[model samples]
Target: MTETARPAYKRVLLKISGEALMGDQGYGLHPPTVQRIAKEIKIVQAMGVEICMVIGGGNIFRGLAGSAQGMERTTADYMGMLATVMNALAMQSALEGVGVFTRVISAIRMDEVAEPYIRRRAVRHLEKGRVCIFAAGTGNPYFTTDTAATLRASEMSCQAIFMGKNGVDGVYDKDPKTNPDAKRYDAVSFDEVLRKNLRVMDASAIALARDNKLPIIVFSLDEPGGFRGILSGQGTYTTVSG
Candidate 1:
């Protein structure tokens, strides 16, 4: 039998929201959600694509939301980072349970629980076909995981960053949920995203991608098997390129 073809991208950075791990509960880690994400990543790994994931903590703790409610900004941000760490561990357990080799690397030092963030070591892990889950956002305050995703993607030299949004298939001219007249874009330039003020990702994240010439693929994570399909270029998604 002929060998199956590998994915086009040799390395990729997947950015998932904490809510994606919540399933139907709308809060906290849901077992089935984590397992499904793990399965998708496993499929990409099998296709020879080195995967590094940066999962958000929005479901557990959104720093901005807390700050809006009268909490200290830095403290809230740190809590958000910790929330991401928890999500990362949950994902790690799910991935390892299926016999997929993985590592959890945290920006903040948590030696007993995970490896501290080391750029070289992260790249090494990917080269060895081990999935690396990056937790903690830039290890500091005033930054979102979206920025961290771009930073990690640039550092890891990933060919593209896969943005797994909860709903809505891709970036649209307007909020599809709010406007029926919203137009979906198949492909777009980073400049246009900024010009149009699209919220596919934060401005900082989009700027970084533009500067480094990294493409961002926006797709709905809720779609069954969509992640694997995107890597194979068979999914409904928007490609933002330089």
Candidate 2:
């Protein structure tokens, strides 16, 4: 087999699960976790790659968690969305602390805190090498940040979506945590993922990616410097495309 190093993508969407922001305590934002993530991103930024980010709110509140406890679905979802905004702000501050230019754009408008989500403005930010942090989960209930990642990727014309996962490296035939013998796939088609009910992202997010012909790369976020390694084609990851 001929081996050739993969080229760095010109622009990319980075989807970070909220659980990643939770450190050893297993709750809320961990400053060190955010700082480490930001540092990895700084390495990629220095490589001349444009980036856009979407951070989930699982660390603070997940709609499913709230709904399962008897809360109204819409209210729970909104709270979950707000939680993502909080995560975005935390990330923005961390990135800026390292001298990386970043802008937090929210699906829900809060003029005092962040810019309202506008596809044009976001694209402009990326073109200028300014990282854009998308928050608030599409500004609508019943939508996960996974879906928002796909939307932003398409909107910004990103070459691929990088899913920064915690613990597990990639999608598996079964829950890796529960089944130690679960088979891991290095590469797979989106259709196969849906056919087998893989829990990488929700169906809506997967469908959007498939429709747009965007490749999704899943990798470990907990690994120090893993984000930069993925961009440099030296990290463990799974690619889903075509």
Candidate 3:
């Protein structure tokens, strides 16, 4: 990475699944993996790109999983939201450890731990070069963190949303893990993704992004320097747009 190699985007929202923070662990956050990802964000920040992050809670508690086990739907979903808050704090600590300024803003307020999500406040933080970690998944049950990411991206007027996946590099024609012959797309239209029921994001989230003309860059977080490489236009990733 060179100082003169400018990025195509000035600001972006990074959507990372809770599973991405788990590394090889079956559940919960892995300190080393979280630190590595924080370094990736720090590198991007050094490039002068403003960032907003939304992390999922599947590593700690998945709403659907809880519901499947007979827990009340709303109750399970709230548990998932709390899990995201925990992940956000962990990420905040890691990013701060590397000297990157961050603000953990939550949709569901717990004033003692995280600041409440206020659009104007978050924008101000970005203006000052601080990464805003949006947590608690819209503060509503049923909506995934993907929707929260899209919502925050739009609210923040981000150039795009960078979705860092754990295993797969990009959107595939089939499950790459299950099918060796699966093909990955370099770029795909939002409608194509929805029509094919691809797993880029949930239908509501995709539709929200499509309606707002927000592009989503899906890439592998497991690859070293992958996030920074993609921003510099040097990596393999899928761009989902209109």
Best by TM-score: 3
Tens-place lDDT digits, model 3, residues 162-225? 9999888999999999999999999999999999999999999999999999999999999999
Clashing pairs for model 2 are none
User: Model 1, 115-209: lDDT tens per residue?
Assistant: 99999999999999899999998998999999999999999999999999988799999999989999999999999999999988999999999
Give per-residue lDDT, candidate 3, residue 106: 94
Residue 207 deviation, candidate 1, in Å? 0.4
Count clashes in each candidate, considering only residues at least 3 apart in sequence or on different chains.
0, 0, 0
| Sort order, lDDT high to low | 3, 1, 2
Q: Which of the numbered candidates is closest to the native, going by highest lDDT?
A: 3
Q: Give the winner by TM-score: 1 or 2.
A: 1
lDDT per model vs. reference: 0.93, 0.91, 0.95
TM-score of each: 0.97, 0.96, 0.99
lDDT of 1 at 93: 97
Better lDDT candidate (1, 2): 1
Q: Kindly report which residue stretches of model 3 are placed more than 4 angstroms away from their true locations once superposed.
A: none
